[model samples]
Target: MRLAILAAYAAVISTATASYAQQSADPSGVWLRDDGNARVRIAPCGSNICATNLWIRDTSKGEEAGDRLVMSLEPKSPDTLAGTAYDAKRDRTYSITVQVSDRSLLTRGCILGGVLCRNVHWQLAR
Candidate 1:
């Protein structure tokens, strides 16, 4: 009986740890841009994932007032997401890949039909 109880407890603890790890691995929260100018909230849409501008430092710029779709991402791999990222201010769209981690978000946006690519890192906000 004692052995069975011990095994059950171990299973419960292992399951709980796995659940926590999975939740932490998911990047579904507000993240601060590396430039320190904006915060974006990432969440699931109808069938895909999207990130919208939640807040911005400059109000006069008319950036954060409207819910802007900055990123439309779909899972491509275990740790990578592929989609398009739009820059409303510049009216530009680029192919983007996002690599998500527990504390950081690394995104690479490609322009000119993949001729040019730029990387940006965003820190996960509490």
Candidate 2:
């Protein structure tokens, strides 16, 4: 029937729209470190997002340095993202905030209880 055909078309359109929305909202990709010594792979994990260590210049240190770091990103604005990095080795979580510009990301990590912190600006890899 015409009604059934229209319903099917609507369902298809809705599904396609939802898929596109998800892809567009995700900033999942491989990003390079500011020093050009490391790379991190960002992707959606479960209902949150995560960044995994992908590559590093120093092979000996890379093996132990790069591990899976789970974090959650909350968009503070259209260009700013705030989150926390759970360091399993240290058994502590660091507060992090990032300002994204096109393919570049300027990130800052701070000690949860103190003022000592570090910042790194990274670029997105093709």
Candidate 3:
């Protein structure tokens, strides 16, 4: 009975760890905006993922180089991550979803309470 319990507990822990890692697919890469203006890098930072702007053509919208969006995301699907992004520079948090593919990335961000939203597409930067 003791051995059985230990084995079952280990199995449960393994399963949980595996599920958590599912969100760790191929989100790390350098991407270019579909508009041909911005270049960003997405990579793991500490325990979460961060999307940082590498280059920006238009800084009029309060965006600049080195701006980063730290995301705490969960695996909503095999290729999607649903979570919130915290912008430390702006002191704002937004509901965000990231859909990742081999050559494309789609990001949707909405202000708190889902009042204002925007969707942007990015292509893998070679």
Best by lDDT: 3
What C-alpha lDDT do the candidate models reach, one value each?
0.79, 0.75, 0.91
> TM-score order of candidates, best first?
3, 2, 1
- Tens-digit per-residue lDDT, 6-80, candidate 1: 999999999987765454335678999898988988887666566788788986766764455566666666678
Locate the minimum summed-lDDT window of 10 residues in model 2: 19-28
Model 3 clashing residue pairs (backbone): none
In model 2, pairs of residues that clash are: none
Model 3 agreement with the true structure over 28-123: per-residue lDDT tens digits: 899999998799999999988999999999998998999999999888777888899999998999999899899999999999589899999999
Q: Least accurate stretch of 10 residues (summed lDDT) in model 1?
A: 18-27
Clashes of each: 0, 0, 0
lDDT of 2 by residue, 1-126 (tens): 999999999999999877655544344688898877779987888866677778777756434435776777776666777778776755778888867777887878889464988989878898
> Model 3: runs farther than 4 Å from truth?
1-13, 16-20
- Candidate 2's displacement at residue 83, Å, is 2.4
| Model 1 misplaced regions, further than 4 Å | 1-25, 59-62, 70-72, 86-92
